[model samples]
Target: MSSAMTNERLARLYDRIEIQELLYRYARGVDRKDWDAVRAVYHPDAFDDHGNYKGDIDGFIASLQQRHAHIEQSMHVIANCIIEFDTPDSALVESYFITYQRVLPSAGDARANYFLREPLADDEAVQGQAIGRYADRVTRRDGVWRIEKRAVIYEVYRGMPTIPGGRLRDNWTISSRDGRDPLELLRIELGLGEAR
Candidate 1:
């Protein structure tokens, strides 16, 4: 390949890595329920459409805060990130995200953690399997890349505000990340594995 072609390829690869890292940060922020961190991933005037939300960046995130407050814990998984750059500073990205919310006990003794263990309840977990895509137009402003526009799409919303461990009570455990595979990490995060 010519020098110019080689340089272009390397630049594209770098851009892809950067976009993936940015997306991972976005997911981490959402999972941690850090609204401020989540907001920082976008431009000041970015647009978003999260199905449950349809507004500008600020308005959309405000709605997210209100909704997220009702859940106890959430996990956001993003994968298969495909970023296509229109220019060195601008791109469109489509990524897959799976979000899970642990529902709080609404009835019975929720605080009572210890009791005769029975079947896990279904009213305590909500899993969203989203074939979601984000359309982002990014630009480097002030020597930093920021998403100028964003749109979100959700493909599946499974389960509900029910207990996630109810069905798989015997499968909950921690993972020791000595050198875990990326796919394994994904499965564990998605509730597809027992506690290790």
Candidate 2:
């Protein structure tokens, strides 16, 4: 009986870790524009209700790609994740997230609609920030965990002018424009293939 209980605990711990990792990978995929990695974490029939955007997985993917097109840099941090198991293969999850993005000046008039930021001049850039919680229903299918549904609740959203000459890069590692970021390239070199 004690050994059986230990096994159950181990299984639960493993599930928790897998679910958390799924959320982290989702963030990484979005920041790096790695759509395949993002799609891999969701059910085919998944629905994402992201305030301004609401639709199935395919539409969600399209919206994501479109939304970030005019933005140059994006960073997302997920924290305070709480998970509750509904069944051996299903769980409810809530994860708090903060996202920071730098919108290019070329966005110009288009920024007013999607970005909700003021129009910028030819050489001006703006930074945007949002704080939200992702309430998700996650399920394990074929021994793999994925999001079945997700609703993003925003607590804060705003944009401001970036400080001039704020960029101070001292390292050689630069984030790639495509999904072939340095980390992914290194992982591939080590035979990891961009997934855990």
**Per-residue alpha-carbon lDDT of candidate 1 for residues 76-160, written as tens digits (9 for 90 to 100):** 7887777777777788887877776554454244322222245446354443334556666677677567777777776765543
| Residue 104 local lDDT, model 2 | 71
Model 1 regions lying over 4 Å from their true place = 105-131, 164-196
Tens-digit lDDT track of model 2 for 1-196:
6999999999999999999999999998888888888999999999999988898989999988887787788889999999999899999999999998877767777555534544555676678899999999999999999999999999988887763233747575667647667888888889987543
C-alpha TM-scores of all predictions: 0.68, 0.90
| Residue range with the least summed lDDT across 10 consecutive positions in model 2 | 112-121
**Residue-pair clashes per candidate:** 11, 0
Q: List CA RMSD, all candidates.
A: 9.1, 2.7
